[model samples]
Target: MIFIDYLENVELISCGFDHNFSITNKGEIYSWGLNSCGQLGLGDERNRNTPCLVSFPNDDLIDIRIKDIVAGNYHSIFLFENGQLWGFGSNRDGELGLGDKNNRSNLTKIPIENVQKIACSKFHLFSLAHDGSSYYAWGSTKYGNWLSSRKLDGQPASFSAASAMILESPITFGLTSKIKVFQFQEPISTKSIIRLFNNPDNYDVKFVIGDRRILACKCYLKSVSDYYCLMFSGAWKEKVEVEIRDYSYETYYAYLRMLHYGCIGINQNRITQLIDLATCYIDKRLMKHCKTFIRDDLDEQTMPTYLPLVIKYEIKELYDKLSHITIEQVLPKVTDSILQNNENSIEFLDWFYNQRRPFIPK
Candidate 1:
């Protein structure tokens, strides 16, 4: 296999009809293969079997760091770190977005800014603004130059339009102002929500665990657990401080962190305690997350330890999965004494051996 070892740490690659382009982590652009229409952006219409460095036209090459590269049938587009776009190669249908039907042998900056993303077809190009709400389309209208806008809920609206002629420049298209546009509040991510955990800034509730106290948000806790929802809404609506007696500070802290950060902050050693806390609060989502971790950690070595816990919690899925473990897998590592000490393990062995006794000779 041909290895291009010189192009180390390549961050992105794009391929055209016959040409290819690559961008390195150091913001360097390289191109090779067919350059019949100057798609290689090498300042000349010469094909290159080996990769060559792509240079900008102006003397400010040092500041022209490329963020992304995309290639069409015979054209190429480059997005810069400053959110500006540049293009080269075939422009028969203005696919280069250069505002003219002329092929460019070198990189030429297009009249667009704050472009977060760029995509192209054989004869059309599309760009998304950094705002993430605005979209633009340009190039051959015969190949359908149009943009369809969806509602904030991701449902398609009954609004779509197509241009009749070639688009020499990028044009903004979406639902007209007359149409109702749903303006939904930006959803908070778990990563962002987790930042508020144990933060005293905007806490509406406090949990006193022995000598320690933890600040928390009522709205967040209410959303995750039915027990918290009822407790906070019914009797403790105005209560700012509540005492936790059943669980240790570590377990309760981990439980709150799990509510905010999912299972990412869960400690493997404290999973059993977390499961108990989840069960006490009747938090099925948290229980499911704990079960998933247990299932993924279940194997020959862990089977003996986790089997009883699985049965205690009535985790039928895990119990059924453990029932399928081969004797070969257990006998090699697990000893008879280890299996005999736990009644659950002994019972599992009895069931397993009885099921396969017909196949075993006397």
Candidate 2:
């Protein structure tokens, strides 16, 4: 049953049997229900029917703030915004990273640091660290393998932070109760937004693009773009007619679509356009997503196309990442023609060679 007094400012929620855990907008934690094994972090195994604030001792005096929460069969762990891990629960199989099977009723700080994300099961724990360059696991060793000592591969995409909430209307008594809904959104090429555009009651403004006019909501535009926020926040003229002449119609539209939704269709044909547009808008998040796309799609044939954009944007992080993938995958096939045709790749090669790191022969 959903509680009538639902939590406010909650960013993420995790649940265990007879209990619930949540991280709030201020990076504070709240837990409700069973505390049989001290999972509630209330300093005792007392059950709380209503949500109770859970906090570390002197939390305000410390630099750590909780950002994520996960739960096991009877245990719970919290991940801090600064990449620290702490836990309080039954540790029958060392699931708490405490290196022992000891039960703790209070939040105990773990030694692990630089942890970006954490996950746990009934008898195991998994942590993604260094933004996913490294992974660490601990807990019940089973299936005849020491999974705890093994390293997992792949880097995680840039972290985007946002707060979301679910709103519920008052409960009605009858099955034939009214269910009226109201939502206003913008028009875009994406199929999801296309249908919303067709609804005459949706848009609040229109953005004229080339030969076509795209309808949009002023609130949405302001939410995603500082430039648009300034323009629509009573700082500029209140005229309904407005024309954007900076970026091309296609790129700007795609950018807007990305802002409305969380994704965009990207390929070799339009990757550069998106990145350039993101750069112009100073949208580091969008730019990071585009770079991650280019990183994953990097190949010997595609490196030429990607390298120039890396250089144009001065993306040193991506430049080094591309160099690492290239050297690790296609070093033996490197040819003089490949180097001659791509100057940016040549620059990467020079940087790689100067690193003085040992490279094993293929």
Among the numbered candidates, top lDDT falls to: 1
lDDT of 1 by residue, 118-180 (tens): 555433343222213334555555345322211122321111222212244434242111100
How many clashes would you count in candidate 1? Answer: 0
Pairs of residues clashing in candidate 1:
none
Candidate that scores best on TM-score? 2
- CA error at residue 130 for candidate 1, angstroms: 6.6
1-362 in candidate 2: lDDT tens per residue? Answer: 13412554444557665567766546667788888888788889988988888867776327766655677667787777777778887666566767667778888877677775555543233222232334555554332222222343342221110000000222211111011111112322344544443135787777676776666777667866886787897654475656767666776676666565444545556678778877876887777767766765565546778889988998787767777767764564455546666876777678878897787799
In order, candidate lDDTs are: 0.63, 0.59
Clashing pairs in 2: none
